[model samples]
Target: MTSDILLLEKNMHINVFGLNHNTAPIEIREKLYCSESDVPVILKKLKDWGLYESVVISTCNRTEIYFCSDDSNNSEESIKKIDAFLMEHFGVALDWLKNYTYRFCDEEAYRHLFLVASGLDSMVIGEPQILGQVKDAYRMATFHNTTGFFLDKAFHKTFNVAKRIRTETRIGYNPLSISSMAIELSKKIFGELNRKKILVIGAGEMCEIALKYFKKEGLTGIFITNRTFQHAQKLAEDITGIPCPLQDIPDLLTKVDMVLSSTGSEKPIIDKELVVSIMKKRKNRPLFFIDIAMPRDIDPEVNHIENVYLYDIDDLKGLSQQHLSDRLKESEKAHTIIEEEVVKFSHWLEQLEKNPLITHIIDVVEETRSNELKRMMQKMKYVDEETLRNMDLLTRSIVNKLIHRHISLIRQNGSPSLLEIMKQLFKFEEENEKEMDSGNEGK
Candidate 1:
């Protein structure tokens, strides 16, 4: 490859290093959980460490860092650096990083991103929330000026691919999100949801969405609480539910038959001790808990309490399979769309790599054609507008036809030998100057 092509290929070195729902359990994923504020810091850190482009996406189910550098050969070292950074920043163990994390480079990395943005790789197949999360991540990266040309194109293409899947396939038809699935599981635990009451902790997007599902089921006495009381009030107002302060969780827990929690809290908010006391106040009324938050808002030990059932994100996985079965056909279609986009994206990168030489080739050929045409026109007495137009069209067509094969060759396989030949053929500066001088003398 020529130096330009080599440089282009180097800049295409995109990679992702992190853990997701499939590769890591909730415990491992939460350890690397990057909140919104953490992304800019991580992006700046990566950039400081010499990455050209980077984006960090950390949701309840996955924590992934997508980055690129103009050193394809050093991808291994770069990924190792990212691994060590995650270990140190998240305080995760080496064993967990080795066993629970996954890394992908170039094509595989972009493919995984497409799967994620399209929700094909979600815990619940065809979930739509992940797309919004991916968009938010991309937006943050761009705001921090961490994404460059390659990542910008890749992410834009990813959005297009996701949109195509959404329009072409019915993957999102009656979609099942983590919240929806949690509601489904709750129905199994407590039949006739309309008769039972539920308390939703944390008024974030997930909690808000879950409340809507709960309301649709005609659930009575919906209570919402959050660390920021205003957010809880806003969500409750939107859903016609009751709003309470975070400190009131203990009181609310005793009255509601179920508790659905999804928050950004870094630790378990409702522990065994708290639940133990709440259960007594409720007379042990079989209160079910859905802890969908990343760090797990409810303690896992709470499951052992009598008449109390607990389900975290991992527990929701079993329920997802049932939803997946219904959307398998659509999921397959979405995967097909992703494969097509990946191939197109690869071709685009190849074209980008070969563009410098291609542009030179076109410039030389077009200038040569223009000089020759000028020389012919100078030889003639005068050319009418119709004749001039015809000649111009004929000359342009001939030039394009002659150069088309060479351009295709560069795009398909930009080998060093071929690049050198095109370079030599198109380096007509001295000859073009002489030809133009001769044409001017004739004039």
Candidate 2:
């Protein structure tokens, strides 16, 4: 029901609307982020809103909502649906969100997602972690059965494009991640990491990356504590750090110089009261906390306490943002890759749209052949078997020849206008839909 400019075709198309690291600050991004638990609920809400084909990509740097719908004619209406859902779930109104967010439709929306999956849109510029994060989000969507045919196809293609970009270009070479920035932040504060006792919370990918970065540093004691002891022990064994239970965090808090947490907890694991008591044990020594988790594993109140510092994922972005010129060069190479892939995907989409017309062409020719053969038979005396066989063969050849050139032209790469011409040349689909609607009304 949207205008022609917004409508991609008469059917569903991939749509993306969200705020990312470039468009929004960390605070804004975090407020919009949907955690692993939150993704399904938000996706379900969107489904209930008739956005049955959708996916949510929420990370430290971005919170994106992608879905399939027919509001290309007026994307604001489609975006309003997403905006309303966000208002309902994330508590941000449409006007407030529009300033920070961007919207893309059809091919452009799909292209944007490909760039995101390939890490061309990341703060670090071609960071490798985003591809995996995107994959994980799609996997979650698949698990919940939220994505429909279009999304599933687009996301799968996006994964392949991301893989190609990483392989074909130097985009991922010498990349930086949020975990590396956290380590750099620590060095900035302590001037050196040689004597800093580090405690890592959680055994997730973020925590693993932080530990990997920390091991390379000259840090003194490294401790691993997580809710799952087996995971904690495994990471600690690999990193040669001591493994501790989640309960041991209070004791570790007192002894450690820095605590890097990346947990899946909904609530803050470290509060002001707990940290204040721990600081008392250390004679008011300074403690640095880096919380990379989405829901925030460390409380903001903890930052207010004396001799304690707290940094979330957003704070880490500043460190990674430096020297953007070098990464931007690599980003250009990724852009070229994405452009090629976008064209490739668009071609596939056009071919898919034209397929129905091709089917109709074949059907029309076959029906004409059948009706003409029956008339000729009625006008002649008992036809011989050989004559009948020859007639059938002759009609089949004529039909194939008649439509061959038209089908060939449709298959070739041409201007965008060619598709509209092909649709106009074949009116069967539109007529069929009209007849079906009329019949339903009559019934």
Candidate 3:
């Protein structure tokens, strides 16, 4: 049964391996996080190491590796090698990370991808952001031409399954956006945000999301700021708030009740000294700061400041999980859709196994019909052109009719014996032609 399944997948296949929030803790996952700018470089390295096609999805909750290859024997070794590379890259030991990783091959891998894209596999189930992240990864793979036929088909089907899950189920209904979860954490730290002045840094999607949630709480005067003043001005206008230059964060910090910073900067934008000064200016009023940016926008030391509460992106996990429980029914429904799609994709893969034989049979029938027609045309030069054309059509139709049932049977059952028979038939024909050539050489 294993051999038969392998034969079927020899045509097209997928394999997935990696760690996520479910299997690994944030400390372990953080080590595996590959930035968008780092992906092309990693892709080149994978190709150099003889791994042909791959897509790496590295998000806060998961870091999944998906690959396609004609050789199945290499899958396990390839994964181990990748694991070693990640350990070296992140300066972590293999022993610490190995136990957290989970590997899936062939159909299981494909199904897992669908579940991931639909957000069913998220640590906080039914989160909507993962779907976009998955699509972005797919688009990158496509741009790099690393996405082959099997991956292309699998990703397209995964996307369709994700759409069906969203449309058919209430999985996303009343879903807690990450920004809302951030706000929930703020409320826990500070009794009520309504009277507190809120400072939102950055004009990115995450900043906007945070703004919406804070606005819902009727926070005291909101300040929108970004490196790009126009963006800050635009967002401020949209939210009916004030705009501050990014450089003025230190000056404005003392006035704000809460600071929510989510930006693309690689290092901390708000340091301990700056925040300490702000705290002094505010007479050390309890200030809640949420840093949702990768690499973290706020310095870790800021948390130690008097009356200042600093929360990093990972700190919101508890609140996010709490929201996930309410959407459990929708998550189950999404899983059902994923399971059904996996079965259909597997059936398509099985049918593809007979494609080589089907192509061979069609070529042989066409060659035979063409050769016979040429011979008949040469022998009967007096035959009218219309009569000859009609005869040719009749012979073509008869050949197709004869091959139809065989083609249908091969497609339906995908029997290995039938493929072996086709291979032997071709081999015999080649041997007979070689003998005929030998006879001519003797003459």
Of the candidates numbered 2 and 3, which has the greater lDDT value? 2
Number of backbone-clashing residue pairs for each candidate, in the order shown? 0, 6, 1
Each prediction's TM-score versus the true structure: 0.53, 0.51, 0.52
TM-score of 1: 0.53
Better of 1 and 2 by TM-score: 1
lDDT of 1 by residue, 256-327 (tens): 898889999898898999989988898878999998899888889999999899988887876666556768
Show the lowest summed lDDT stretch of 10 residues, model 1. Answer: 1-10
lDDT of candidate 2 vs native?
A: 0.78
Question: At residue 228, what lDDT does model 1 achieve?
Answer: 89
Q: Cα lDDT for residue 393, model 3?
A: 47
Candidate 3, number of clashes? 1
Q: Return the top candidate by lDDT.
A: 1
